[model samples]
Target: MTATRVCALSELEQDSAIRVEVEGVAMAVVLDSAGEVHAIGDVCTHGDISLAEGFVDGDTLECWAHGSAFSLRTGQPLNLPAYEPVPVFAVTIDGDDVLIDPAVKKAV
Candidate 1:
């Protein structure tokens, strides 16, 4: 599937995450301090919590409910209780637009 426009670059804040759904797939769109954009599955693997509502520390998004920090680059949880990794989607920056394909998982 073609990558669909999720949000504008201007809509994203540095070192934060926003929840967005593309083609029924929910993802957390994040803009790190380095200015790179990342897209990962919004649902936390262990407890089915929303990872977008969690904390952003460097390249990891920590699950607030259980303190499981998942890497934004690989989507693997760094701590206990979340052994499964979330899906990391390939992100595309076209001008000021941030695009992501729900069907495409980045090879980490």
Candidate 2:
């Protein structure tokens, strides 16, 4: 799997999500409230909206369009309107850079 550098760790705010593209795959990189970083599919399974534009609550990300909340670590939807789980990617922190492997999705 090819590891692509998405962003710098300093570029991410605490408890916020950022939109990124790795090899044409849209992804949402989140820095949860607990100061942990996670990478998941950017699109909301319930709608066509981007998850990075949603709200970050702890380890969960709430989609702004349909109000579907998803677990950052597992990519499982925590609410209705979204039954399918999003893909979760593997993340690596190399010094100040945040690297993501779009080809290496974490198994549910």
Candidate 3:
């Protein structure tokens, strides 16, 4: 599938995550402290909580419900409870637009 425009790059605050859905797939779009953009499955692997509502530390998104920190580059949880890795999608930045294809996952 083609990449879908989720939101503007300017809409994302640095070091924060925002929830976005594309074709029924929930995802978390994160702008890291380094000014890099990342897209990962929104649901925490440990629970039904949204990762977008979690904390951003460097390149990881930590689940607010359980404190499992997931790597923004690979979606791997760095702590217990969440042993499974969320799907990481490819992100494309065009001008001010942030595009993501739910069908395209970044190979870790």
Candidate 4:
């Protein structure tokens, strides 16, 4: 599997997320309160808008389109308006760099 470099670990803040595009796929890289990294498709399942534009709190990514929240860890739709789960990538921290595996499939 090829791992694409996303950003530096220091670039991500705790409980915050960032947007990045890899291989023509928009992705949201999130850092939870516990300092764990997660990668999910930037698009919301229910809408064409990007999930990176939404608000992220704790482990849930709140879609700004219709307030559908999805789990960052499992890519499960936690609320209504988004019955489908977004694609999730695998995240790896190498030294100070953040890498993501786009080949990883998202969970529902």
Residue-wise C-alpha lDDT for candidate 4, range 1-108, written one tens digit per residue: 689899999999887778999888899888888889889999888989888778889999898879999999888899898899888887878999999878876444
lDDT of 2: 0.94
Worst 10 residues of 4 by lDDT: 99-108
Over 1-108, each residue of candidate 1 has an lDDT whose tens digit, in order, gives 899999999999998899999999999999988989999999999998999999888899999899999999999889999999999999999999999999999988
Q: Which clashing pairs does model 3 show?
A: none
Cα displacement (Å) at residue 46, model 2: 0.8
| lDDT for each residue of candidate 3 in 1-108, tens digit (9 for 90 to 100) | 899999999999999999999999999999998999999999999999999999999999999999999999999999989999999999999999999999999978
Residue 73 lDDT (model 4): 81
TM-score of each: 0.97, 0.96, 0.98, 0.92
**Tens digit of per-residue lDDT, candidate 2, span 1-108:** 689999999999998999999999999999987878899999999889999999999999999988999999999999998999999998999999999999998766
Ranking by lDDT: 3, 1, 2, 4
- On TM-score, the leading prediction is 3
Return the clash pairs for model 2, or none.
none
**Global lDDT of model 4:** 0.87
State residue 83's C-alpha deviation in candidate 2, in Å: 0.8
Looking at model 2, residue 107 earns an lDDT score of 65
For each candidate in the order shown, give its overall lDDT on alpha carbons.
Answer: 0.94, 0.94, 0.97, 0.87
